[model samples]
Target: MNLENTLAFAKRQDEADELRDFRNQFLFPKHEDQNFIYLCGNSLGLQPKVTKEVMSHQLDNWANYAVEGWFDGNEPWMFYHKELKKLIAPIVGALPVEVCPMNTLTVNLHLLMVSFYQPKGKRFKIIMEGGAFPSDQYAIESQVKFHGYEPDQAIIEVFPRKGEDVLRTEDIIIKIKENKDEIALVLFGGINYYTGQWYDMEAITKAGHEIGAIVGWDLAHAAGNVPVKLHDWGVDFACWCSYKYQNSGPGGISGIFVHEKHFSNQDLNRFAGWWGYQENKRFKMEKGFIPESGADGWQVSCTQVMPMALYHASLQIFNQVGSFEKLRNKSIALTNYLEFTINEVNKSLGTNQYTIITPQDPASRGAQLSIIASQNGKQIFDGLMENHILGDWREPNVIRLSPVPLYNSFEDVFLTGQALLAITKKILKSS
Candidate 1:
């Protein structure tokens, strides 16, 4: 479909969208008494309307029952996260045992790495994508240092060939093969935060396994924005935070996946804690740590019920919408329409400054498009914000706009494009 010259077409698509009504389910932040055009789901999603209700219920339970709320209530705090697995499983395409809602994203990453990144002798280096999120980079560097190995020696980063902004699947496979001997683990983001590039998780897993390296993924940008198949992909492990595309509010609890293959491995050593103990005998105050089976074995502490409640409420909406298949279908159409509109506006302005750094191929990205305004990047970004279009600016020049499927509409995309066109003209004239 030709996206340019297509406002009518966009309206038609929105009218027919099965998920269209979901836009009203979110709480939009306002500016100048207008609902802001929120296109920042890649950074932080708009809060779901149900968040307050869910959070309040948990709060009231806490207020009335105190310590008894842990086991006495209808939705007891002790097992609050249990309801989340089925809702979350389909989003990541993993079995219930393979995933759990707990901790923050980077924390879970460190824990998963501790178990999977068992670097020994020469086969201990980790292969990751270059320019990953700063938090992820720090986690990997610290993990390497903690292992008594220098970061440079234990971490191997694969970058795109010069001039290209995104990595190719073929290059990643080649890198996996080249470092087969030294690489102990292959961990990278499912969708890159900066470039908005979605990596081939299944292919990456296959390549890593071929070299006898365990494969893990940081899916912070991918989990709700795209489809994943951690179980079918044979990924060794994965972790994700729910705050972004999942719309679980800031610092919402994260999740982890441990492949079923690891469940029976008694020899796998982990830093043990009381919460990881078998549920039936957990309160026995046993002298030895007999860990629970499956992903629960990785639990390091008591579950955070408040964050889990918020996450659970958001996840329930995903369940109601069915699968990522349905949500991702809308994502492609919405983002493509936005790209088309932006390009059309760019042509009218006679400037090529706003180039989309995200790949054009739908398979290579999610809803987010990293637009690099070559001239006056920050100025244009500030202009967009002042006009109440809430896309975020990253460092030097890129403004990341994500048309989130669940709570964003076609009109939102159209309005933002128009706002951007006006903003660009004003910025250029003033500059």
Candidate 2:
């Protein structure tokens, strides 16, 4: 995969791409009547063209059926989530019974902790990646406090070795083993949000199980961006949001996966709600809480139809694509081209103006590359924005760019490289 920095080379690659037509399925933002080169799907994915139509159908159901929409509509609101589970199962590599579309990401994390993070005897500590998304850190800290454990003592974070930007798998496994006796749960983000490093989930799951700990993942960044076999990997539980790489709208529905092995464990605790009661007897208003079988038992309330409709629209596109393997293949090549172009900019300038901190190996990362600009990072980011090249900027220095396989093209990556090179030259001349 020798990548050239010329636009002609990029155009040639685009002409050869089998998935090139997917770009037309999304609506890109415009600047002065021209489409911007959008490379920020790692944050919020572009909306599908069919999203509005799907949402409108749901809205009409609300208008026509009103209270009876739950059972009367073509796709009954009562069983809407069931359909979603079928669509989502293949993406995360779980059985339909093992997955449930419900609640927000952090809320599901908390609910799962109720069942999986029961600390007893000497096993009271929770191990997680350092620099996790702040919500997860807060959730773990609060959950530890609720169980009468001090945050500093009960939470152990495995950090990268000094001078490195990503966590090493060996370091992670060693940490899990070293604290085996005290660990109650091993929770981690499927991919580090800032560094875009995809952790080896299978290895982490096996290591945690060996230590007698419940293992789970916050797959906010990993769920749609990379491949995961949650059930086969023996993960105890996992959760993800649909907004990012999944291409659901902002603040879209989140989903959860609970291994079938946990279904019959009556000893496990859950904060029960009526929605989680056995569906056939739910309306009977029975006495004791009889949990529904499988992951559906975790549901706390009725579905949010509008958001689910938007999510369903995106899931249709995912179903059309048929496999995450195909999307992942394109993702690797797209990201590799971006990385190569950035290096070409550095070479031409005869200075290392941008340093990519993401793992160089394709297997260790997804589509994102976190770039630390040598100087005036924010100013350079602003320049990119002004040039209609949309990417996201992190604090202090890094600029995160993700070329989403579903929509972004090779030409978009080439335009980004050209813009970056021009901006760097302008900055150098002024300085």
Candidate 3:
């Protein structure tokens, strides 16, 4: 993979990509009458071409059928998630019954925590990666507080060694072991949203289980961006949002994964709503709450048809493309190409001007590369935006560029590199 600055090389890579046609499936944003080189799929994925049609179908159903749309519409609004389960199951590597699409990400996290995070007298601490997404931090803190525990005493945060941006597997295992007796749950993001580091979920799950702790994940950045084997990983549970990389539109509905091992366990308490009741008798409005079996039992409300339609539209593309293996294969090559080009830019800058804080190993990262823009972070980011290269900035010094496999091309990466180089020169000159 000799990725270079040559336009011919980028064209060759695009020509060779089996998934190259997928780039056209998205609605790319434009600036100054030209489409921007969108490399921020890890933040919010590009809109799928089918999304509009799907949304229209739902809107038409609403207009024509009114409240009866829940049952009489072409795709019943009541069971919209059932239509989506088959599509999403393969992406996360789970059984259809083990997965359910519902709520937003943070809401799902809080719900899962309510069921999984049972803090008792001695074993009450919750363990998580330090500097987790603020939503996750708030969810955990609120869960701990709800349990009548102080967050400082009940939440234990594991951090990398001083001055490090990523956590080592060995260090994580050791931390879990040290707190084995007190930890009630081990909740972590499948991939660090900021660092783009894919944690070893299987190993972490095993460690947490050995300590008698429930293990769960927030796969907001990992769901459609990487290969996941949630069931085989023996994870107790997991949740993810569909907006990022999944291309389900902004604030899209989220999903939850519950291992079948817990399916028959009647004692598992959930904050149930009418939607979580047995489907056959749901409209009966029975006196006692009889929760549905399996992961669907976790549902707290009726489906949001609009978000579900958009999610189904995107998942239909995933289905046609076969597996995440296909997407992930292209993702690794695409990200590696971007990394190689960025490195070349660093060399040309003559002082290691750009340093990628993301893991060098393909196995440890998704498509995102977090570049630390040392001297002129904001200036370089703003300049790249001016060139119609849409990436995201995480305050202070880091800029994240994610070349989504579904919609981004190799040429986009090449152009982004060019934009960075130009931005660097402009910023350096100004400084």
In terms of lDDT, the best-performing candidate is 2
Model 2 sits at a Cα RMSD from the real structure of 0.7
Candidate 3 structure quality by residue, lDDT tens digits, 213-240: 9999999999998999999988999999
Whole-model alpha-carbon lDDT for candidate 3: 0.90
Instruction: Compose the digit string of candidate 1's lDDT tens values, residues 88-130.
Output: 8889999998888888999999888878888888998999999
TM accuracy, model 3: 0.98
RMSD of each: 1.1, 0.7, 1.0
Best candidate (score: TM-score): 2
Superposed model 3: Cα runs more than 4 Å off: none
Order candidates by lDDT, high to low.
2, 3, 1
lDDT by residue (1-431, candidate 2, tens digit) is: 67788889999999998888988989999989998899999999999999999999999999999989999968999999999999999999999999998888999999999999999988999999999999999999999999999999999999999999999999999999999999999999999999999999999999999999999999999989999999999999999999999988999899999999999999999999999999999999989999999999999998888989989999999999987898999999999999999999999899999999999999999989999999989989999999999999988779999999999999999999989999989987898
Clashes of each: 0, 0, 0
Give candidate 1's total backbone clashes: 0
* Candidate 2 off by > 4 Å: none
Reference-based lDDT, each prediction: 0.89, 0.94, 0.90
lDDT of 1 at 60: 96
Q: TM-score ranking from best to worst?
A: 2, 3, 1
Estimated TM-score for each candidate: 0.98, 0.99, 0.98
